[model samples]
Target: MNRTDRLLAIVLELQGKKTIRAEELAARFETSVRTIYRDMQALSEANVPIIGAPGQGYSLMEGYFLPPLSFTASEAVTLLAGAEFVQKKLEPNYGVHAESSKAKIEAVLPEQVRLEAEQVRATMRFFSAREAEGSRRERENMELLRQAMLDKRKIRFHYAKTTGPVLQRESTRVVAPYGLAHIQGAWMLVAACDLRRDIRHFRLSRMSGLEETSDSYELPPDFNLEAYRPRDDRELKVILLADPDIADRVRESDIYYIDAFEEHPDGLQIKLRVRRMEDILYWVLSWGADVTVLEPESLRSRVVKEAQKLLERY
Candidate 1:
């Protein structure tokens, strides 16, 4: 970016954060520390009210604020689309705020820009993939869990494990709530499980009879929800040949573990990496004869056995 844009961005960054070091600004703007120092000097010369300390970094002066900035039509549309997604996907508490935010953004846009943004927004739509019953339950659980997290309380609930053996299907759990994550169209609670004595992720849809307990707990000092990423140990590689007719459908499904797709004379060659054979057994079964497991003799044997069982049942 040009120096003019960089200077304005630096001031905006300072306005947003409590303080930022020269190195941090340099990294954020993808420039050198020397350039950052020169930019700071230029900003000070322009009377931007940036206060710098020897070791404390830089911050905007108290009560200093930037005037309203204009947005391009595309930018306005992007913000509106984000607001719309939040309204449709998140719980009601956030949905209300998103609606208000959308209104405020629309109020500030130029009439022509607003019209263009609205036209672009109208071309797109957001819809919940979940059923009404599941969506309602998830929303209720999300609000309750959000409150529990804020209050630093433990919660008790009956959780149903959709996978695994039937005997271990359902169990009551008492957990110290940490945070929630929305992954692949589902809400998952990341918590400290009292029973397992470790952090676990529980799907909200599978939870029943959830209630906050009188007990309270403190979050771990080192744990940060925004920085948390579940460990992935998917080493097993499974290859499959999919019928050409169904290739488009498979691509549209957006299966998370699909590693690559290659065109073949017979059909499409699909490469999948997963944690275990069982992790993708059902998905493979769903495609029936259209998808043939080419490797991992174990998965192939399991599929044969399962198909035999189905035949016996019929």
Candidate 2:
């Protein structure tokens, strides 16, 4: 760890309700005891209320603190403002850290501008809701997959295809884990299933769990992820009139060629490509009255067929 992290670790270690000996910090930071003393002196010069006792080591007094890093007054305000916005909109996992940051800024803020910060914080609010992110299990599992990929270990897992039953897969005999990706609303783990194997994509939500083995695997030197995701394999072709309301979103991704549009009575016509019909169908349906599929008789037919079947069930 660098100097900033080393100091934070020292404070955290002390915060856990035990005096940390100078020698202990020296050993932890791989520095000499005299260097640690000099660091302590530096901490004190920065207004850290570190009280030292004979044989009892050192402790920080209440209201005294270690700087996350040295900051100018303007920098502190900017940091606190951004963090305050994040604190309002994000979940505890994200916002709680922002809270600590806010406190750190408040700790060193000068008396004159501190009230201004309070006023700003009192009036400020952040937009955007906390998205449903990965669960702890999901995060741990994903980390394991990353380690396995780097170590070239073989991995196994159960997978459920959308149209089929779940199957217990023993892919380690052939494949090597390559990468994990989250797109749209789903997470996909990509891998090469065998030597010279084509890249395969698996849905994480549909996966039961993962297993890794001691065995290592290798990929062809020329392997690239784009080689696996074929530009042509996108099976569904679509044409639509995009609602002007979501034109900004269209501008965000290269997926839709906006200039290719033709003016319609309602909106701009757009062409879209899809590897699978379901996802794009859901996406289009999300726009409600704003979008209409213009071409590809097969896709329209399938939608109508599904709607008819649903009506009967209803």
Candidate 3:
């Protein structure tokens, strides 16, 4: 980038972080340390209020702030697209804020840039594939859970547990809601389950009659939602041979647990890793004769048994 842009970016970077070493800035901008020193000197001359300590690195003065900056057409389009996603995917409250944000951004943009951004954004669309009823319910649940989390209150809800294609059981749970996450187009709540005495994930679609309780609690200092990752011990391997005609379709389905796909002389070899036989049982059944299980005799037997059951029902 040009020196002017580099200087502006340096100030912005300083504004973001508490302190950064000269070597770090040099690597970030892809320039030599000597050049970075010269740039720092130039910034100081321009009265940018950059403070440098011998051991500590460079930082902006406490009260220093940047003036309003202009956005490029591409940048405006990106922001607008994000706002569009929020409007379509998130709860009603966020949708309103997203709409207002878009309006404010558009109001400040240059006419030419705004028009350009509009043209680009016109080619894109965002919509949920979920049924309207289901989507609305999840959004409502999300809104309630979000408020409960913010207010440091516990929540009570009825959650249904599913095994394979069948509903296993339903139970009421009172949990200290921690955070919400959207994964695979579904909303999940991560919370400390009072009954289980451990952290658990609850799918919003499976939740009903959610209500905030009068009880309040504090978030644990060691718990961080952003860094939390559930451990999965899906060691069961299931291999399938798919007919060439359906191989592409199977791949297109984007099954989350698929480990690898290989070319087989007969057709395609698809390897799957799952936590339980039930995890893949229904999916295998869905393909009918087009997919054949080649390993794990237990899964094969289960598939045959389910197929026999289907035949008996017919």
For each candidate, the alpha-carbon lDDT, in order, equals: 0.90, 0.66, 0.91
For residue 174, what is the lDDT in candidate 1? 99
Q: Candidate 3, TM-score vs. the true structure?
A: 0.88
Q: Give the candidates in order of TM-score, highest first.
A: 3, 1, 2
Q: What TM-score fits each model?
A: 0.84, 0.48, 0.88
lDDT of 2 at 277: 62
Clashes of each: 0, 2, 0
Better of 1 and 3 by TM-score: 3
- List ranges where model 2 is wrong by over 4 Å: 1-137, 163-174, 219-232, 242-263, 276-279, 282-291
Candidate 2 lDDT (Cα, 0 to 1)? 0.66
Error of 1 at 300 (Å): 3.2
Candidate 1 at residue 87, lDDT? 87
lDDT tens per residue, model 3, 103-175: 9999999999999999998898886666676678888998999899889999999999987669879999999
lDDT of 2 by residue, 1-314 (tens): 77766766777666765577898889988998998888888777877677888897888786654445555555666888889765653334557899997887787777667776677567756554334333334444666677788888988776555522324343323347777765544457777765445767766655556778778887668777666563356556678877887765654644422235566667677776666665466556556556667778766676677668768999
Better by TM-score, candidate 3 or 2:
3
* Superposition error at 309 for model 3 (Å): 2.7
Candidate 3 worst ten-residue window by lDDT: 127-136
| Clashing residue pairs found in predicted model 3 | none
